[model samples]
Target: MNKKVAIIGGGIVGASAAYYLSTLPGGDQINVTLYDDGVGQATSAAAGIISPWLSKRRNQQWYQLAKDGATTLMTLARRANLSTDVYHQTGTIVTRTNEKDLHDLYVLAQERREDAPDMGEIKQLDEQQVKQRMPFLTRSQPGIFISGGARVDGAALVEKLLAQAQQVNLIVKRERVKLDDHGKVITSMGPQRFDQVIIAAGPWINELLKPMGINVDVRPQKGQLLELSIPDFPNQENMPVMMPEGERDIIPFGQGKLIVGATHDDEGQFDLSITPEATQDLMTSAQAFVDSLSADNIIRSKVGTRAYTSDFAPFFGRLQSHPHLLVASGLGASGLTTGPLIGRLLAGTLIYGGTPDWSNYEKPLSTYLS
Candidate 1:
C-alpha cells in the first residue's frame, strides 16, 4: 500500500514540501494532502527579498541555510519554469552611510564567497554608480553589489508549487484542520489517518500542538509592507534590490512595481488591519532614499503574521517522541529566503529513508520543541 502524508499549512514551507515530495523521484508512491486556513499567511504578504549574502546577521547556521537556499530556490525557479515576473535574479545593492562599514562588508563578502561562490560577484560602487543602477534612489550612501541576489513573488510561487504537485496525487484543503491528539490528526471534513504528518504552519503551529499539551517556543509577529507603482521610473525591472542598513528594504519587480516597507511589530499581536502610522513610517523611510517617492504612488498594503522563536533561530526535524510527526517553524522574516530549502530537507528525510545530517543546518529540533 502507498503511504499517506498530510501537510498542515499552505505557505512556502508546506507548499515546497508538497512540491518536492510529489514531483521528485519515487513521488508517485506517496499521496499528499495540504490544509491551509488562509488567515494572515506571511509568505503572501512578504516583500520576497532573497539576498542573504550581504546580511550582517552572525548566525552561521542561518547564513549557511539561507545561502544555500538562495542557490536552490533560484535553480528550482528556473527548472520549474517560473516566469521572470514571478522570480528574478536581480542581484542586490547593499548600502551603508559609513564608507568604512561598507568596505568592511565588501571584504566579508569576498571572504565568504571563497566558501560560497553562489554568493556571486562582489563589487564596490561609488555614489554615482549606485545612482545610475537605481535612478530613483537619492541616498548618497556607497553600495556593495552582490550579483547573485534575487527576488521572488512569494504568493505566486506557492500557487505554482501546489498546482504542479497536484499533477501527482496531491489534495489541497482550503479550510483549517486540527490535531485532536498526540498522533491523531482530525479535520473538519472528517477523521483521517496518515502514515506521516508535517506541520509547517507558521506561528499557529503552537495552537495545533497546544491541544496535545505541547507548546513550542514560538511567538507571532505582525509584519506590514507596501506596494508602489512608479510608471515613469526607468529600468525598474533591471534595478537591483535596494537594501539599506535597516529594517526597510526596497525591492523592484517587473513593470513599474516596487515593494517597500515591512516593520517587525512584536506588539501588534495578530491584528491584520493596516495601520496609518505604519504607512507613514514606511513612506518616510522610502523617502529617505527616493525624495521623489510620493504617497500618491501607493498601491496597497500587506499585513501578515510571521513566526519567531525566543532565540530567533529556525529549527526543523521529526520529534523523537512522535516519530511520525515532523514540525518546522520559527522562520521569522527570512522565510522567503530559507523556507523552500527547509521544505525539501523535510521531504527528503522521509522519501529517501532515514534522517540526513542536519548538524550544521540547525540546533537540535528539541531546542524549539519540548
Candidate 2:
C-alpha cells in the first residue's frame, strides 16, 4: 500500500523531506506531491552559515536543534552527492565588538566542546592571523575559529534536493495549496487526498491552514541580502564565513562570490522587494572589512520572508487533534540551520512511527500550537 504524502512549501524542509523519502529504505512505498509558490521563500535568500556553536543565545533547545541540524545537513550532502559549489566545510570566523564578550564566547565554545566535540578545534586568532587566514579582510578584528563550521548555497541545495527527489516519481507543482477541515489538500487543479500532509510553508503556514479552523504562532520576517562578485580574487572560494558584531555577516562561495548583510526586519512583513537602502547598508558595513562593495562589484540583492514565533522557539510534530497533519515553522533566522533535521525527523516519524524527542524543548508543541 503506497502512502500518498503531500508536502506544502518546497523550501528547505519540504524539499529535504522529499529527498529523504525518495532515497531512504522503504521509500518506494510512499509517494510525494510537493507544492511551492516560490514567492519570498526564506531559504532562497538565506545567509547560509552553519556555525551554531558560537551563538550567544541561551536557549539550549534551540542550540541542540541547530547543532543536530548542521550534522544532518552534512549527511544529506553526502547522500545526495552535492557538489562543492553547493556545500563546503569552510570553517567560521566570529568577531566581537567588545574584547571581553569575545573571550566569553571562546570559553563558552570550549565548555560546549566537552559535551559535543564535533565543533572541531576552537582557538583565538590575532588580527595578523585573521588577515593571513582570510587575506581579503581589510579591517581585521580579533576572532575565534571553529574548524567544523560550514557554508552552503541555500537555493542550490533545494534545487538539488528536488531534482533528486523527482527521480523517484516526486510530483512538483509551482502552485499554492491549502488544507480543508476534512483533511484534503485544496489545489487549483482540484481537491486531492493524501494519507499524510506536512506543511513547511515558512511564515505562510497560517494562510494554508486557516480554512481548517486552526492557527499557529508564526509571523513574517523579511531578510535582505547583498551579493557581490570579486573576479580573480585569491582563494575567494575557500574563505571561511565571517560573523561580525552586527546583522551583516560575510559568506563566501565558489568562484569569488561573496554574500553579506542578512538584515532581520521584524516589521517588514512579507514584502520581497530588494531596496536600495538595504543594499547600501549592506555594502557600507561590508566595506569596512573587504576592499569593495562598490557599484561595479555589486551582483544583486535578495529578499525573503522568514517565520518566527513570539518567543522565537520553533515547534514541530503531528497535530494533536489531527494526527495525520504534520507542521513545522517559526525557525526565524535559524531556518537554514534547523530546517533539514526537521524534515528528516518528519519523514522518519511518518514512516517509522516513533515519538520525536521533546525532552530538550521547554514547551514543545504547546509553545506554538496546542
Candidate 3:
C-alpha cells in the first residue's frame, strides 16, 4: 500500500495542491483526498484579480508567492487546453483622487529600484485621457497610475481545477474533518489514515486545529461586493481598475459588471452576512469614481470572508511537534493571486524529500518549525 495524504479545504489552495501533487514523480502511488464543507464557495469570493505588481510593498515572502502563483495559474490554464481568456491580462489603472493619495503613490513608486522589472509604470493621465481610456468615468480623478495586471473568473478556475483533479483520481469529500493525536483524519463521511495531512481551511483552520495544540491566529475579514450592469460604458473590456479611496479598494471585473467592494470589519464576528451599511458605503465609493453608477444598475450582491494572520503573512510548512501535520492558510486578500505557488511549495515540502527552494520566496520550513 502507498502512503496516503489528506488535505482539508477544497478552495483554490487545496485544489491546486492536489493537482500539483498528482503530477509529481511516483505521485500515482499516493492517495490524495480533499475535504471541505462548502468547497470553493466561501473563501474564494472575489474579483480574482491577478495583479502581481499591485502588492509590491507587502512582505518579501508574500510578494514572491503572488508573482509566482500568478505565473503558475496562467501556465496551468495553457497546459490544460483551457481558454486563456479565463485570465484577462488587460493590466490595471489605479487612480489617486486626492493630493495626499497622489503623494503617497508617488512615494511608493519612488521606492522601487530601476532594475526591478515587475514594477509597473507610474504615469499621470489627464481628464480627457482618462475619459478616452475609460469612458464610464464622469470626470477625471486627481492622478491615475496604469500598470500590468490581470483578472480571472475565480469560480470557473476552481471548477476547471476540480475537474482536472477528478480525471487523475484525487478524491473529493465534502465534510468536516476530525483529527486524532496521531494526525489521522476522520470525518462523518468516512475515516481515513494518512502519513501526512495539510490544513488549508482558511479562516476555519483555527477552529479545526485548536484541539491539536497548533494555535493559529487566522481571523475572518468580511468583504461586501456588488455587481453592476451598465452596457453604456465604453472600454468595458479593457481590464480591471483599482481606485484608492482612503484605505479602501474599488475593483472592477467580468462583462459589464464592476466588483465594488470590500470592508475590513472585525466587529461583525465572522458572520458572512452582507450589511446594508457596507453596501451603502461601497455604492457611495463607486459613485465617486463613476457618477453614473446607481443602485438600479446593481444586479446582485454577496459577502465573503477572507482569512488573515496577525503578521499578515501566510503560515505554511509542517507543525512543530506534529511532524505528520502541515498547515497552509492565512493568505488574506491575496489567496487568488498566491494560491498556486503556495500549493506547489507546500506539496513539495510534504511529498518530496524536504523543503524546496522557492526562488524569491523565503518562508522556509525551518522558519515555522522549532
Candidate 4:
C-alpha cells in the first residue's frame, strides 16, 4: 500500500525531508506533498555557517549532531547539483577579544579536532596570518582556523531542494495547513488524508498544531543581519569567514557583499522588523572587525525568525498523540547546517520503519506537547 506523506512547512527541514523521501529507494511507495507559506522562515535569512567545531559546546551528543550536520553539507550540495562556490568552503576563523577567550577557543579546537578530523587542518592563526587571510578583518587577536568551514546560500539551497523534490514527483503547495480530526491535514487548497504528516515548520509550528490541541515548545527567535558592500576589499575570493571576539560573525558573499549578523531576540512573535538598535549594534561590532566598513557601506538589512526550543535541540520523530504526525523543527541557527541530515534520518525512519541510530537527537514532540 502507498503511504501518503504530508510535509507541512517548506523550509530547509521540510524541503530536504521531501527531497530525500522522493529520491531514496523505496520512497516511491511514499507519496510526499510539501506545503509552504514562505513567511517568516529562518533558512532564507540564515548566515549559513556549517563549521560546528567553532562552537564551544562540550556535550558530546550535541557535538556529534553538529558534526554530522557539517559532514552532510557536501552530499547535499551534490544532490542539489550546486557548485562549491554555492555551498562555499571558504573556511572560518574563530577568534576572541581577549587572551582568555582565545585560550578557551584553542582548547575547544584541540579537544574537538580528533573527533572531527574532517574539519581539515585545524591551525592556530596569529594576528598577521588572520589579517592576511581575512583582509577585511581589523582585529589583531589570534584565532583558530578550520580549513573545512563552509557556508551556503540558504535561499538558493531551499530553491534547489524544492526543485529537485518536484523532479521526483513530490507535490509542492504554497499554502498554510491545519490538522483535522482522523489524522488528516487541511490546507488552504483543500483537505487531504495522508498516512504520515511531518511538521518541519519553523516558528509557525504552533499556528497549525494549536487548533488540533497539540503544542510543542518551539518559538520564534528573531535574528537580524546587515549586508555591506565592499567591492574594493582585496582577496575577496579567498577571505575566510570571520568570527571575531563576540557572537557577531562576518560572511563574505562575494561580489563585494558581506553579511554581518546577528541578534538573537526572543520576542515571542513573528516580527520581521529590523530595528535601528539592532542595526546599529550589528554595524558597530562588525566595523570593529572589518576596518573598511562604514555606515555608507551598509547596503541592506533583513530578519529571520528561527525555530528555537527550550533544549536548543531540534525535535524530530512521531508524536504519541498523533501517530501519523511527525515533527522536525527547533533547529535554531543550525537548521541549514543539519537540515540534510535531519531530512535523511526522518525519511529513513518513515520508509524503513526503524529508529536508526541518528534519531537519538530526534526527541519526540510529545515530550513538550501541551
Candidate 4: RMSD to truth: 2.1
What C-alpha lDDT, on a 0 to 100 scale, does residue 157 get in candidate 2? Answer: 91
Compared with the true structure, what per-residue lDDT tens digits does model 1 show for residues 1-370?
Answer: 8899999999999999999998778878998999998899999888687888867788888889988888889888977899877788888988887879988998988988998888787889988998888887777468899888888888899999899999887999988888876767888867789999999999999988887778799999999999988764766787788788764888888678888968889998688999998998889888878788888989999999999999898889887878898899999999988999999999988787687788888888878887
The candidate maximizing TM-score is: 1
Residue 226 of model 4: what lDDT?
90
Give per-residue CA lDDT, model 3, range 105-193, as digits (tens).
66665464243344456666655665666676665565545464666656667667777877775888878887765567879856677
Segments in model 4 whose C-alpha atoms lie over 4 Å from true places: 232-235, 357-359, 362-364
| Ranking, TM-score, top scorer first | 1, 2, 4, 3
What do the candidate models score in CA lDDT, each in turn? 0.87, 0.84, 0.69, 0.78
- Tell me the TM-score of model 3: 0.86
Question: For residues 225-296, could you state the per-residue lDDT of candidate 4 as single tens digits?
Answer: 898888657657667887777658788876787888878888735788889888988988886876767789
After superposition, candidate 2 runs with Cα above 4 Å error: none
Model 1 Cα shift for residue 352 (angstroms): 2.1
Instruction: Give the clashing residue pairs of candidate 1, or none.
Output: none
Query: Judged by lDDT, which candidate is best?
Result: 1
lDDT of 3 at 96: 65
lDDT, candidate 2, equals 0.84
TM-scores of the candidates are 0.97, 0.96, 0.86, 0.93
lDDT (tens digit, per residue) of candidate 2 on 1-370: 7999999998899999898888778789999999997989999777588888877788888888888898888788888899877888888999876889888989988988887676889888878888887877778888899988888888999999999999995999999877787768999988998999988998898887777778778889988998888664677777788887764888887677889868888878898888777788888878888765587888888899999999888888888788888888998888778989889888888887767776574356866863
